[model samples]
Target: MSFFSIFISTANAAGSPLKQFEIYSIAPMHFGNVNVSFTNSSFWMLLVVLVSTLVLSLGVRRSSLVPNRLQSISELLYEFIANMVRDNASQDGKPYFPFIFTLFIFILFSNVLGLIPYSFTVTSHIIVTFALAMVVFIGVTIIGLVKHRIKFFTLFVPKGIPLALAPLLIIIELISYLVRPITLSVRLFANMMAGHTLLKVFGGFVVALGFLGIGPLVVTVALYGLELIVACLQAYVFAVLTCLYLNDALHLHH
Candidate 1:
């Protein structure tokens, strides 16, 4: 058999469907000399933003002594993030509450939106996640410098270290600081991509096996539920880490 045929046969044996994901270019645009291609992922991202805005806005539109369902949910979400900020970030970091809260909400919405059928998973792409990571990285760096001026470099120096080991410690610190963006971006992108891919493969098996595929179908359903939890958890993790990073910038803790 040809390679394609063999691949299909293997998928069949493993109870995977033969469906494959395709990346499509939706539009081409130019910024100065740079060219950018908008894709299906971009569309889904916009949709997530719109839906999130509507949901949150509608939920908080009215205030009652005892909140109705929507108001209660909105208040709960607000309190959750407010507590997260208070717990992780210092007093000096309170001004950044809006940015951090929006970051969490956007990530949560995008992840949940991607779970819908026929939807594109924007967080699955390294470029998209990396861009978000870079924003946090760059913003924190700028904040550190503005707050500490030349003394911001002190962030790289660990307190109580011996003079002889100071250089080594600074080197390690610099490397760790430089790697934050890569780690942050890769963690989100890899988890989302892997989970979605596994879901797709298992879903394909259910379709291909006809009546015999009930086992995999049930497992896929279970995994889908689990993925929803993971999606929310990952968003919370990303936001909490961002808060931690902001705290480091504000306090210059080693």
Candidate 2:
């Protein structure tokens, strides 16, 4: 069955609007005590990767003096992200353009794909977003540690602080530093999930109200467009924050 058809059936079978977000095993597997089953979430994530790779590869494959639609889109995205990295993360961050670009594309596609009726929204799941955030957190931490060694700890201790305030300030900085993953993950997760849930609610009302549904139908259409913009914005926000964090690791209040 087609993915959309399967999702439509699954979603229709469940009453709750949030049931659309549920993850269920498509192909079950087990190894000893471990249950590592293929799931709807996994399928959508894999699809995102495939779609991103395919579009980008095709977009750049036939490079031209005057670009076609795919090439134009590819070049635009590349320049946009390259400038973003340079502006936010500085010259040192140019080396990591591929990572930032990939992160942005992946989340953007996942968020956009979820807007389709009954498609699973991977970023709406805390586990997925948290995992992505942790990768960034750990990566930047390692980069800082490798570049500055013990001096990396200075990130948690601002310069020119009063002696009395130094300890408290250090504690505050440290706590905030550690909370990066939680905040970053929750921002994307909460936005995507809440937006989808609200859309679903209004959509249901439109159906139930019939002719009186015009008001709710109009609201639902507007919400979908808003969510589309929000999906792209959230991806940009996440990528920008990542660049900012990487800048801290690379330049560290220089």
Top-TM-score structure, candidate number: 2
Q: After superposition, which runs of candidate 1 have C-alpha atoms over 4 Å from their true positions?
A: 1-21, 27-38
lDDT of 2 by residue, 10-96 (tens): 434445688888999999989898998999998999999998888888988988899999998889989999999999998999988
- Give the alpha-carbon lDDT of every model: 0.83, 0.91
What TM-score does candidate 2 reach?
Answer: 0.92
Prediction 1 TM-score vs. true? 0.89
Off by over 4 Å in 2: 1-14
List pairs with backbone clashes in candidate 1.
Answer: none
| Tens-place lDDT digits, model 1, residues 131-207 | 99999999999999999899989999999999999999999999999999999999998888888888887776777
Model 2 CA lDDT for position 91: 93
